[model samples]
Target chain A: MSARDDILGSVRRSLRRDRLSDEAQAALQRRIRAHERNIVPQRGSGSGAEIAARFIDEAKSVAVTVQPVASDAEVPDAIVRYLAQHNLPARVAMAPSAALEQIPWASRPTLEVRRGAARPDDQVSVTPAFAGIAETGTLMLTSGAETPTTLNLLPYDHVVVMRTSQIVGSYEDAWDLLRQSRSRADGLIDMPRTVNFITGPSRTGDIEQKILMGAHGPRRLHIVLIEDA
Target chain B: MESTSHRFKENAREGMANPSLQRAMENMRRGFPDKRLAAIGRLPEFDALRDRARDIKNHVLEHLDFYLEAWEAKVTAAGGHVHWCRDAEEARRTVLAICRRLEARTVTKGKSMIAEEIALNPFLEANGIEPIETDLGEYIIQIRNEPPSHIIAPAIHLTQDDIEKSFRASHRQLDPGRPLSEPHQLLDEARSLLRDKFIAADVGITGANFLIAETGSSVIVTNEGNGDLTQTLTKAHIVVTSLEKVVPTLEDAQTILRVLARSATGQDYSVYTTVSTGPRRPEDLDGPGEYHVVLLDNGRSRMLGTEFHDMLRCIRCGACMNHCPVYATVGGHAYGWVYPGPMGAVLTPSLIGVDEAGHLPNASTFCGKCESVCPMRIPLPRMMRHWREREFERHLSPAASRYGLGLWAFLAKRPRLYRLVNGLMARVLGLLGREHGGFRHLPLAGGWTGGRDMPAPEGEGFHQAWARKRRERTRAA
Candidate 1:
């Protein structure tokens, strides 16, 4: 017998069922289709400014540096200031997202911005987050033509420019937003090739349980939180 | 992958004796449990979430075949392939076949206990395909040519000095004067060295934290983001995970994720929780061109309706081991396999066989700490007892233990005889040990007294003391 058949057959024998009953199949399908939420944490379940404040607090606790920009126009100046503070380079690989591309990089003459996917040598990369989860201060990033996944993984310093309005109270809220936005004709959510929920810069406690940041990904994660409604 | 599990007593002795291993285990004992408690304390819904997570897994396991079929259809719909393997040999061959077709010379791998279970690196290297572990812990152990001592912390048995020595010996390009005193410096060295390998690797393999049947998405939770780098940069991404990892939907996966990171490393969320749906889409500029999921059974199917079925609910959080006294004392290597501690005690026997791994179950003290901390609420002590019973029934237990139990069983059938023998023995031992308050040596219990003194029994037997107490109470009334 084929491995698949043999394995399935064994499982069936153990379960004492020859095949899935019509009722059983329907129930299982219903469970998948419903995709119900279970016990969302109350800590990040607040709304409005509370969620944003909670997000910043949680983010800062994990050693993420959050800069609350007053508006979208202030993003460029904020990035420059952050880079200068961290002693990072003027060069950055920016994602081609409309929100990021609209930023007036021309105003900053000293900054060198390369658009599209990040190169291996790129020291800093700026990408727009799809959402910010308030529960864990996680940035929800999706891979696309505009937001190349490499921009999230290949750089030493990662700058995420997300608005306060983009921050959700919980992971379930974020999932609901995704399902609403990307529902296909078949009713299944058309997920991106990759959806990364990044809470902080990459870290490793592998060596003697001493946490050292930037093991394989970004060493510094700078969030320019634009206070936009 | 070889079973030193049979010689668990000897392995445990060496594990305890090794100064470095003892030091590493001490750090683990101090670190994981406290952090987990703090993480869970932050969330009021932690226990409720764990309950829901257990229910979801139980539901999935019950309808596993149905979910597997549904998940496969979804995977194919999303332009991915699903390979089914009955055993480790088939799983290894399936991975090799994929690499051969891709003409992959070097493969970058994320941390996978499944890979360790199959001994993938050696097999791939023998086939002239180099497999590089990208996770920091796995990387350290890989270079050292040693199996992971801990599941989550693979090189938890090694010290910073050991890592520095390994790097210096293997990385000949390193300057003699370069500072390697700090963990940061070691991390940076590995990061820079592995970056080129990540870029150069033709195939990238990873293990799935959970496979969603809803959208054919495979979820990976990692603190270091090596998994993301491994899967994204390569031409093909091969996920070598067991069949039991599948959940019904993304929401179900999320419920498990809520408890997973907290239980594993005390993080509310890992630094990176990435969900990959098949290969990269047509419009995607990055990610792998091909996606394959190798669904490995390897004896899990037989565990479906058995007494050990709850063992499948493990999410590999390592919480059970973290809280286990036996694990804290001897460390992960003493269990002698890819998995360790209470989970391994129950699971190794089922996967490898009780005959080969009988000593693992016997290694536990039935402390029940592992069960209390287990997110799935797996009755670990009960399963270990089951294994002991199985061993005794099959006569796989040592003759000494069987004979001792046989003598107790024989005497216990007759209460008068049992009481007479016990009363005499207790008085004799109590009188003998009145000075030291314990025995330094014993005839039948050499194993118990080998390491520490066994406390002496009281002078009177339990029945004699109980009768005396009852008579005194009646007279007073």
Candidate 2:
């Protein structure tokens, strides 16, 4: 017998059953398909304006800087201002999302914006978030032709562009947004190669329980919020 | 890994006597519990979420076989390979086979207790492949040639000076004269050192926090984004996890994730929660080319429907240990296994054997703190009692304790004789120790009172006092 058969057989014997009955299987399948949310805390729920305020507060608490822009057209200027404020280099590796590309990179001749997955040499990178979870100040980025997972990890400084309308109050709402964004004939879309929920810049408290940032991922995560997307 | 659980008593004694270990453990005693309580205070529905979390795990375990089958199908549909291994040997071989096929020279790893269970690093090194631990804590302990003392924080046992020493010894190229006093200085050193490993690695392996059966995703929750870099930059990504990690859907996974970091590190949510479904899609610009999962069922299949079946509900949050008084004193290495503390006391036996780990169950003081704080609400104290019973049944306990228990059982059956014997002995002891009020030592009970004085039995026995009070109350009425 194969390893799978042997292991499953032992599990069956331990559970004292031949197999799951049709009714049991159907109930489980239905639950999976429905994907019902359970017991989401009311803490994250509020008006959209309240959520946006809470998102900034929570994100700041975790050491992420949030900058608000009046519109998508203003994102490039906000990012450039942030770069200049931090005295960081003007070079950035931008994820190849259509939403991000529409921001005229040529408008800023001083900014060298390379579009693709981040290289080790890149000091900063900007990626468009699929959704923003206000509950924990998390940016949800999905891997695809547009946004590679590498764009979120390799760079030292990460600037995420999230539209104000894309922010959800809770993780459950974030999942809902993911499902609605990509509508197939079926309710579910196969998960992209990776769905990353990055809350704050990378940190570790391993050494004597002292908080230290910039362990392996980005040292600084700056949020460029498009208020009028 | 190799279990020194049989040497628990000696190890615990040495752990208590060591000044450095005691100092480190003091920080944990204050840190974990206080932060968890404060975090719990912020969330009004923390208890309710814990109940829902327990229910989700119970439901999944009841239909584990079916869910495993479903997960396997989804993984295949997503173009990922799933390998089922019945034992640690098979699991190790399965991983090595993947590495050999890809001609991987070096493999970078995220923190995984399952890798420790199979002793995978040594096994891979023996087969001409180098395995690197990427997490800061795991990397610290790996350099020192020590197993992780704590699950969530592997390097908690070490001080900054300890890390500086290890780095100086291991990183010969670096200047040893540089100041490395602060935490950030140490973190910066490790980050620069491991970045090359992440890029040069051929394969990346991580342990799954939860395996989603609905979408075929292996989710990892980490504060550092090293796990993402390890998997994304490599040619192949492998998830080495056990059978019990699977939950029914993304929603169910979220329910447990809600309680996981809050209970462990007192964070609302970890910095990074990444879900990897499979290898990169055809249109994707960057990701691994191959995705493989080796599902090990070493002794977990047998744990289902047993006295310790609830052990599988654990999410490795380390709350049980944080709250356990006995664990607070002795620390993790004393348990001498991949797991430590209250969870280890119950799980070590089931994974290894009762005979090897019998001392762990008996080591507890039955504080019930572990059960009260357990997010899964596993009856940890009840299971420890079961292990003790199993040990007694197998005649594994010492002979003197057995005879003492046998005498107590004899008296317990004869209530009248028990009361007479107890009253006379109490009166005699009360008279004998009238002046001193306590005894420094007593015959046969020397072992119990070795640490401190045993208070002398004073006044009438409990039954006599209760009877007299009852009679007086009845007369007054």
Candidate 3:
């Protein structure tokens, strides 16, 4: 027999042996039914830009800065200008999303755009979040064609350009959105196998309760809140 | 070997004396719970997810026989071996026999609590095969000859200075005067040291976070990626886990994962979530040639048909510990044994017998904080009460305690006599405490007064106070 078939057969035998009494089974089923009915819906209001600004203020980082995306036409230019003002060299990494590509860069000096691999010192990396949760200021990033999970962790400074339309109030709202998006495609929502919820920059207090940033992951996070992008 | 009771007292004394550990614990107490609350607050569906996760665990436990059988079949089909041991001794024997067959000399372990439960390291060493603990925290404790203090953190009690001191004493070829002060330096030193051992070790052993019944796979989640490297590099891979770790499907595992990291370290997920289905396939590269899983029963089967069965739903998240006032003060080692805190208080009694571990149940203040934060929502205090009942049934209570309880029961059964006796005692106690309205010492209450003074009760008890108030109201009306 194949490995899968053998596993299934074993499961059947084990289940028969360990099956609970009829009364207990029925009680458990009722409990599960009650649980499903009482599940709460996620939050509904708040734009991505507003959510980003709130998170930045709450983070209270001395080094990191938060700024609003000027316009859809000038989003890329604004990011470039911010990096230049901070005296950081401009060799930015871009996510393969249409929203990211739509940033008008044809008239500007050729910015080196690399794919697949990332370096530690890379000045800026721009990625579009799948959804932004307004409740706790979390960016929900899922692995897909447009946004690879690697872009978020690879650079020194990360610029998460979240559109106002994609902002949700809670995780449940994000899941609802994801489930709806998945049902449209054949194999989209089988659980991306991985969904990362990044709250803030990487930090540790292992040394005498001294808060040190950039212990392992990115030290600085720059969230560009795009209005109606 | 040091008994868990002895270890508990030793660790408690050390914890009480160590000011640095106290300060560290104080910080952790506020940090973990606050972050968890913030995280849960953001996710409106967190309650729903918790409920779903609990249901999934319950379903798996009810049909555990089926899943275990299925797992065995799949594992066997994939050229892996499965052993079911009814107790710890049997489990130890099975592991030893496997090592003997392979003539294994050295075994490198990847932070397995189950292995500690079986006392695998001492058993291996007694049989002449050296066992090395490869996890950084485990390695430090192994050198110092100390048991792990915490489940997840392990060395949470130790400061960087303590670690440096240990390294200075142990590392033969090291600059004694050099300042060894960075987390990365310590991590790098451990990585270099363990990297060689990982390659040369005859066997690799680990514990499972969840065993997937659908695929006969064992899943391990680790932050350092050490578990992955340990299993992949070794010729043989062995998983030692209790029967309760099994879940029916990958979806169920995912639901559990959603809460697991959040409860443990406030992470969405650990760095690596690995699923190893039996030995490496013929076409696979850099994987173990032989795979084995030992499913330990060890009193767990007996717990299934008892009231304590809900305790099996625990995923070992340590949330109960994080929120526990006693654990926050004394830390994990105080409870003594493989498991600690509220979960440990309930579990140790069953695994080690009520007579040997009866004190654990009574250690709680019944503050209900543990149950409130428990992701599985296992009523921990209630379970501890069940163990206390068992201890009473076994006639394990002290003679004085039994006599006191007997007298109290007699009085309780006869309300008139109880009221008269209590009234007399209250009047006498009230007169004695009239000066200060409290006592520094009380007869037959040494334990209560040993550390602190007890506040004197009011002149009237609740029943008398209530009755007089009612009479006054009726007269006015």
Model 1 Cα shift for residue A228 (angstroms): 1.6
Q: Compared with the real two-chain complex, what DockQ does model 2 have?
A: 0.88
Compute the DockQ of candidate 1: 0.89
Candidate 1, B423: how far from true, in Å? 1.8
Ranking by lDDT: 1, 2, 3
Which regions in candidate 3 have their CA more than 4 angstroms from the true location?
A: A1-229, B6-14, B97-105, B472-477
Q: Which is the leading candidate under DockQ?
A: 1
lDDT of 2 by residue, B1-477 (tens): 788999998998888898888888888888988888888888999999999999999999999999999999999989999999999999999999999999999999998999899899999999999999999999999989999988888887777888988988999898879878877888989999899999899999999999999989999999999899989999999999999999988889988998998999898899999999989999999999999999999999999999999999999999998888888788789999999989999999999999999999988889899999988899999999999999999999988889989999999899999999989988888888888998888887776777568777876799988999999999999
Better of 2 and 3 by lDDT: 2
TM-score of chain A of each: 0.97, 0.96, 0.73
Instruction: Give the Cα-based TM-score of candidate 3 against the true structure.
Output: 0.73
Please provide, for model 1 over B289-339, each residue's C-alpha lDDT reduced to its tens digit, 9 standing for 90 to 100: 999999899999999999999999999999999888888788888898889
Q: How well does chain B match by TM-score in each candidate?
A: 0.98, 0.97, 0.94
The order by descending TM-score is: 1, 2, 3
Q: Tens-digit lDDT track for model 3 on B1-477?
A: 244653554666677778877876887777778767866765667777788888888877776665576567667866788888766787788888888888889888888888888988899999998888876778877877788766776666677778777877887686777667876566556655776677678888888998866557788876554565567667788889888898765556767776777787665445455667676655442367789998887777667747788899998877888888878778777777777788888988788877667777877889999888888878899999998888788888667778888999999999998888887777778778989979999888776687578777677666677899999999999
lDDT of 1 at B72: 93
Candidate 1 vs candidate 2, TM-score winner? 1
> Residue pairs in steric clash, candidate 3?
A10-B69, A10-B70, A11-B70, A14-B65, A14-B66, A15-B66
Question: Which lDDT value does model 3 have at B39?
Answer: 63
